[model samples]
Each structure stands twice: as structure tokens, then as C-alpha cells.
Target chain A: MKVKAYITLKEGVLDPQGKAVEHALLSLGFQGVSGVRVGKYITFDIQVRSEAQARDQVEKMCQKLLANTTIESYQFEIIQS
Target chain B: MKFGVVIFPGSNCDRDCVHVAQTVSGNKVESLWHKETSLPRLDCLIIPGGFSYGDYLRPGAIAHFSPIMPEVKAFAERGGLVLGICNGFQILVETGLLPGALMRNVSLKFICDRVTLEIENNKLPFTCRYPAHSLVSMPIAHMEGNYFADSETLKRIEDNNQVVFRYHGDNPNGSLHSIAGVCNEKGNVLGMMPHPERVAETLLGGQDGRLLFESII
Candidate 1:
């Protein structure tokens, strides 16, 4: 199995990098963009037999390594590979 | 007093920390490799700044699982004095030795310059040489120095006075409460973004940074 973890700054957390991206887009004449937030996308291969097992393992990975619970939140999708 | 400065694979400031801790502060110092499973009895441990493990995944993420961290965590749990500067601060938070996490700077640029820091609490073992609210200049060099925590942790720290140092003038990295440094609830472990090791000698510049090492000694 494979999993994709999307890690992002939690709501109400300051996203300076995201803000800078938003400003850069505005200066470049990008229109109708209300906000811009930046996050990380990571995928990993897991040797799990079932989707439930992959999800469980990925959740632990996200909590322990992929995401920092103090400042960021994450979600993952277990794709049957 | 004796000190040990942990040296991660990519650590660049370990030598500077040695100079400050040994030559400047006149304390015995040793370099502890990151893979070491044991530590010598020492009064203080300094985790200096650098891109440990090339900051893969996130700053300090990989280093948290290094061989030495188990001992470091045990030392911290026993109230051993630990000071994490710049990249070291990132590692400390990542290892759960401290709360909060360092995020990318608000400007999305690597910052390397001297910034004024206000000593929020001089009562800490690490800051007692400086008077409360005293402003001192130190160099901060890092891209991910902005600090963030959940509302509950922020509130708890605010009430507990865990903040040890804060930016004096304009908020440099967009850290909450202009925080440049903080300590754990027990106040034994300190993590700060600024590099006091770089400014600890008069030949380099003013000796304001020496006060921190001096106080610890």
C-alpha cells in the first residue's frame, strides 16, 4: 500500500510563507485569490496487507514524524497499491 | 562547571559553542557525537546551531530519532540543564523536550543578522546574569525560526512565564509574543533561535552574549 500525507499549518497559526506566496501572486497580477496557504505533500510506500492497516500505520507516522502536532495538522489517504 | 555540546552530523556551531563554553566561560567542555548512547556527568549541555541531517523532512525531524536523543530526553527529564540555540532549538522542540515548533520565517527568507532581544525572565538558570527586561543584541541565523504553538499551550506559557527572551523591536520572525526563546515549565531546558555562541567574546563584538554562558557557569 501507499499513503499520501498532507501536512499544513493549523487554522489560526500564522502562515508567513503562505502569506508571502499570496503577495507574490498579487504582484504578478493573479486575480480573485482570497488567500494562500502553503503546506507539504509527502507519499510513502507501506508494506501493509489491508487498507485499515495502512491507514493505522500512516496515522502513526504522521503523528510521530510526518506532522508536528504543535503547529501543524495532517491527513492521509491510503491508496491501494 | 562542565558542559557538553552535542555535535550532529551537519552541525556547524559546535566549535563556536566549545569556544564559548570552555575558553570564554572557562568551563570544561566536551563534544558529544550524535550517535553516542551515553553522556558524561555534566552540569550543562548545549545543542548548537546547524542543519542537522540536512534538515530533511523538517528541521530537527530526523535528528529527533538520533541515537543520542534517548539519553538527552532522560537528562532533560532529570532536570539537566539544556540550551538549544537556533537549529538546536528546532531539535529540542521536535524531540518533545520543549513545547511549540519553529516554522518558516514570515518573510520566507533566510535571516542572518543581529537582532535586539529582551530578557523576559532573568530568573532562569540560563539568563540570570542579565537583568529582567534588559535588551541585548545577538545574531539570529535561520529560515525556520518563527515559533508556533496551539492556543492552549500559548495560554499556559503566558500564564507560567515560560518565555525567557523576546524580540525587542520589530517582530523578526513573526513569533508569537515576539518570542525569541522559551524554557520548559521546570525551566531547566531552554530553546532559543538566536546564536549567543557567536557573540560571546569581546573580540567578535560586544560581550552581551557572554552573559548567558557566564550566568550558566
Candidate 2:
């Protein structure tokens, strides 16, 4: 099973890197582009028998280590490939 | 007081802390490797500054899962005094042993320089040598040293008098209200981004940093 986790800073939290990227984009002539919040994409393989089990395990990993719950939120997808 | 300094794979300031503890304060200090599962008896534990685990993912985010962190958490929960300096502070917050997270410097750059710090409260074992509201200069070297917490947690920490140090004159990192350091609710643990151990001797240009270690002693 392939699991992917997308981690992002929560709302109302300042994202300096994302802001910097947004500025660079504006400088490059991209217009009307806003809310450029940058996030992380992590992919890993799990040996779970079922997709549900893989999702459960990856969710646990995200909550425990992949993402900091205090300032970041995470969502994941389990792909049976 | 006897001290132990945790050494992660990428920790670069562990010796600086050991020097302050062993030579400056004349206390026994030991280096506890991250893979170790047990710690000897210690009065104080220091997580020194440096780019632990190369600051990957985020400062202290990866290092907190080291093999020794569980033991460190247990020790802190037992009320043992824990002092996290710089990268160490990041680890402490990541471990949930301290309130708030350290955000990137508002300038989005790695800042390294000497800056004045206001002693918000001197009642702590770490700051008892300085009079309250007094000022001291210390070196700060970090890209992510801005202290941030939700407004509610900020209010609680402020109401509980957990804030121990604030930036004086220059807010180098745009930390929340210029916060440089804070302690746990019980005041047994402290995490700060500045490197006090770096300026502990006159040879380093100032002895202000020595007082903090002496106070702990």
C-alpha cells in the first residue's frame, strides 16, 4: 500500500516560507494568486493487508511524528497499487 | 549541580554547555548519547544549541523522537530541572515539555548576533542571580527562533508568570511580544533560543552568561 500525507500549517498561524514563495511568485508576474500556503507532501509504503488498516497506521504516524498537531494539520490518502 | 547534556547526531553545542557546566561552574557533567536508553543520576539536564538532525522537517521536530527522548520526558515529568538552549529549546517544545513553537525568524533568515535580553522574572533557579527586570546580553544563532503560541496559551503562560526572558531593545526574531525564553508551569523546565553557554566567560567578551549557570548551581 502507498500512503501519502499532506501536512499544512493551521489557519491563523503565520507561514513565513509560504509568504516568501508568494512574494516570489508575484515578482514573476503571476497575478491574482493568493492564499499561497505552502505545505509538505510525504509518501511512504506500508505492508498493511487492507487499505483501511494502512490509512489507520499512516494517520497514527502523522499525528505522532509526521505533523505537529499544535501548529499543523494533516490529511492522508491510502492508495492500493 | 550535576548535569547531563544530550548529544544528538547533529548537535554542535553540546560541548559548549559541558564547558560551562564543568569548567565554568565546576560541576560534574556527562554527555548522554541520543541512542542511550538510561541516564545516570543528574540534577540538571541541558539540551544544547546546534542544528540537531540538520534542522530537517523543522527545528527539533526530528530530534524529539530520538531513543533518549522518552527518558528525558520521564525525567522532566519527575520535576528534574531541564534547560534547553537554542536547538534544545526547539526539542523541548516539540516534545510538548514546553509551551509554544518556535517559528522562523520574521525576516526569514538565520540570525546570529549578540542581543540584549530582559530578565522578565529572576525568581527562577535559572535566573536567581540577576535582579528582576535587569538586562543581559547573549548570543542567538538560529533561523527559527520566533516563539509562537495561540493567544489563549499566551494568556495562560503570562498569567502564570511562565515567561522568564524577553528581548530587550531589539526584537531580533519577531517573537511573540519579543519573548526570548519561557518555563513550564511548574518552573522546573526552561527552554530558550539564546545561547547563554556561549558567553559564560570573560574570554568570550562577557560574563553575564556565567551568572545563569551559577544561579542553577
Candidate 3:
């Protein structure tokens, strides 16, 4: 099965990269942008059999490696396709 | 006192750290490779700054999984003194040895210059030689030195007196609350963006950074 994880800095944590991107976009003639927050999207292929197992494994991965729980959070979804 | 400095594949400041520790502490400093599973018995362990693994993904990302990290974690858990400087600080964050993460500079540029730092907490084993609120000038060279943490964590750190250093004048990286350095709850581990080793001698421009190493001794 394939799983996708969305990792982002927790709300209220300053996102400097996101802000810089927003500034660059505005400078390039893009307007009406209020804000921007950047994040990481990771896709992994695992051998898990069930969605429950996938979720558990992915959460463990996030806690141990994928995310810095002190400032960021991660969520993963198992894809059937 | 004996000191050990971890050397990752792309670490450029290991020699600098070794030289400073040797000079200031008057001790023999050992360079431990990242693949080693054991750390030498020592009075202190230092993770020096540099582009570890060329900072392939994010700063300190690839180096976090280095084989020696587990031993480093164990050393910290045993209340051993650990100091991470600049890229070392980022590695500490990546290893979960310290709170918060270092994001890109708010200005989106690599910052390299001498800046003043306020010694916020002098109780740690690393900063015992400095007085509270003492201003010391040190050089910081990094592209991702902006520190970020959640509000609750920030409050907890403040309450626990974990904040050890803050920017004295203009905040260079837009770090939250101008935090330049922080210690762990046990006060044995410290991570900071400033390069104290770089300014440890008068010939290097100033000797203010010597106090940090002196404190450890």
C-alpha cells in the first residue's frame, strides 16, 4: 500500500520560508495573497495490509523521524489506489 | 578535562571546536566519527557547526540518522554535558535533544557576522562563568537559524528557565523572541546558533567567546 504524509509546522510557529515565498510571489506581480505557509508532502510505499496498521506505523514514523513534535505535526493517509 | 567532538561527513568546524576546547580548557580533545557507536569518556561532548552531509535535504536532516547519534542521545540522558553550535544546534533539534526547529532565515539570506548575545541564564554548566544578562559578542553563520516553537512549549521553556541566550540588539534571523540559545530541562545540553569557538581568541577579533568554554571548565 501507499501512504501520503502531510507535515507542517504547528499553528502559531513562525514559518519564515512560507513568508519569504509569499513576498516573492507578490513581487512577481501576483496579488490578493494574504499569507502562505509551506509544508512537506511525503509519499511512502509500505507493506502494511490494513489501513489501521498503516496509520499506526505511519504515526510511529512521524513521531520518531518525520516530524519534530516540538514545533511541527504530521498526518498520514493510506491510499488504496 | 577531556572533550569529545563529533565529526559528521560534512562537518567543517570540527577542527575549530577541537582547537578552542583544547586551548581554553587545556584538555585533549578527541574527534569521534559519526559511524562510531560509542562516545569516549569525557568531560564534555561538542557537536560543532558546519554543513553536515552538505545539508542535503534540510539543515541537519541527513546527519540526524548518523550512527553515533544514539550514543549521543544516551550520553545526554545520562546528564552528560553536550554543546551544539550552529549546524550542531540544528542537529540537536533534529535529534530531539533540544526543543524547537531551525527554519530558514526570515530574510531568506545566509547570515554571517558578529552579533551581541545576552546571557539570559547563567546557571547551566555551560554558562556558569557569565553573569545574567551579560552581553557577549559572537559570530553566527547560518542560513536556517530562525528558531520556532509552539506557544505552549515556549512558555514551558521560559517557566523552566531553559532559555539561556537571546539577541542583545537587532534580531538577525527573526527568531522567536530573539532566542539565540537554549538549554535542556536538565541544563546539561545546550544548543545555540552563535559560533563561540570562532571568537574564542583575541587574534580572532575578540575573546568574549572564551567565557563559554571557561564556564565549562
Strongest candidate by TM-score: 2
| Global lDDT of model 2 | 0.91
Q: Which has the better TM-score: candidate 1, or candidate 3?
A: 1
Lowest-lDDT window of 10 residues in candidate 1 chain B?
Answer: B19-28
Candidate closest to the true structure, highest lDDT: 2
**Candidate with better DockQ, 2 vs 3:** 2
Model 3: lDDT equals 0.90
Q: Candidate 2, residues B160-193: lDDT per residue as tens digits?
A: 9899999999899989989999999999999998
Runs in model 1 with CA error above 4 Å? A26-30
Regions of candidate 3 where Cα sits further than 4 Å from its true position: A26-31
Check candidate 2 and list the clashing pairs.
none
Tens-digit lDDT track of model 1 for A1-81: 777889998887888778878888988999876567799999878897788888888888889999998888898887786
TM-score for chain B considered on its own, for each of the candidates? 0.98, 0.98, 0.98
Better of 2 and 3 by lDDT: 2
TM-score of each predicted structure versus truth = 0.96, 0.97, 0.91
What are the per-residue Cα lDDT tens digits for candidate 1 across B45-109? 99989999999989999999999999999998998999999999999999988889899988788
Mind giving the per-residue lDDT tens digits that candidate 3 earns over B1-217?
Answer: 8899999988999999999999987878999999999887887999999999898757887789999999999999998999999999999989889998898888879999889999999988899999888999999999999988877888999899998999988999989889999988999999999999988999988888889999998
For every model shown, the clashing-pair count is 0, 0, 0
lDDT (0-100) at residue B33 of candidate 1?
A: 98
Clashing pairs in 3: none
> How far does residue B70 in candidate 1 sit from its true spot (Å)?
0.9
